[model samples]
Target: MRRTKVDRRVKLHRELAEFIDMDLKMRGASVILCEIYGKWKGLREKEKDHEVVWPPMVIIMNTKLDKDDNDKWLGMGNPELLEYFNEYPAIGAHHSYGPQGHHGISVLIFESSTTGYFEAEGLG
Candidate 1:
């Protein structure tokens, strides 16, 4: 059977979720939610032609940890996670705190070579 783009994407999402789950477990944190999705990025060149790029595979992770804990964790940094990002064609990671500081969200962006429009998908 031939594998379609959707198949590949699903596999990628599963793998990413597993990897993140493991990492969070190792860090003694629990995942409240995990989302894997894509978005389109517009690029304008000096030439009159407009180009569209598939930005990156965004993995939004919501953890059970609070803002203070999340902040401390992020401040310490994750070398392993950094290494994983470095290994792939990725942008980077961003961490944000919830309004009430009850939970935190971490966004990991992995750059994709393909260019096209895609919808967001949630894994958790």
Candidate 2:
């Protein structure tokens, strides 16, 4: 067998929600990192920049994703995630906040077989 396995480390904004871990658990999604959006937060932490930097978003991915899968996702800017398993490995934005917090979240979905290349881009 090909033994297809595609995995990734998704970093989401902290101010997006109270508990993304709980949200993922509620939706039954595996979690790679369960900490707040610190890198960005840390930057302005000393300055106490309490501005909304990360929005509410969900990173629902089926681990064991393959390079081919990632290749597909790369093409599609952002497509629905739940339509086809191993096809479009993403589904929804789940929730979000203002521009500052809204932008930190970035995700893309693409499949080379059926939909060709579709997308919705975010960078939070």
Candidate 3:
């Protein structure tokens, strides 16, 4: 007998994400994405770690905003977006957004190694 357990009021939401990892060989799916966002905070000049390396990146910035606005993307503004660049420093934003920022960044970041923010902490 197949018992179908149904819980009322149980609305399900789905989250999707992608990233390339040597450990997973690009296919773990432990989660569509990392359940966590916050990693490190502030980094310094001198520290030793393995994950703290300049990884490859693939970005798709606010194409929905402006193709020329490399400095900025979306409402994030040229400055805020650049700040992200200087901080983690991505390769570039692809800007594959639709007419609205809703389907924003559909195929950028993640999987693209460098685009992902490196934990600011841990000096390296």
RMSD of each: 16.2, 19.3, 14.0
TM-score of each: 0.30, 0.23, 0.23
lDDT of 2: 0.33
Estimate the TM-score for candidate 3. Answer: 0.23
Off by over 4 Å in 3: 1-55, 58-74, 77-79, 106-124
Model 1 misses residue 23 by how many Å?
A: 32
- The model with the greatest TM-score is 1
Candidate 2 lDDT by residue in tens digits, 18-75: 3544554665656443332232334446675554312223343332222343232221
Off by over 4 Å in 1: 1-53, 64-80, 83-89, 115-124
lDDT of 1 by residue, 1-124 (tens): 3679889989997986676556556656553533222221233234645543334445445433423544543221334445644534345666664455423455555444221122212211
Name the runs in model 2 displaced over 4 angstroms: 1-18, 32-45, 53-124
Task: Provide the lowest-lDDT 10-residue window in model 3.
Answer: 8-17
Tens digits of per-residue lDDT for model 3, 1-124 = 1232232212221211223334334444353234333233323425544353344333333424443444433544434454555654443433344454323442223223322443222112
Q: How much is 100 displaced in model 2, in angstroms?
A: 27
Any idea how many clashes model 2 has?
19
Rank the candidate models, highest TM-score first: 1, 3, 2
Q: What is the clash count for each candidate, in the order shown?
A: 0, 19, 15
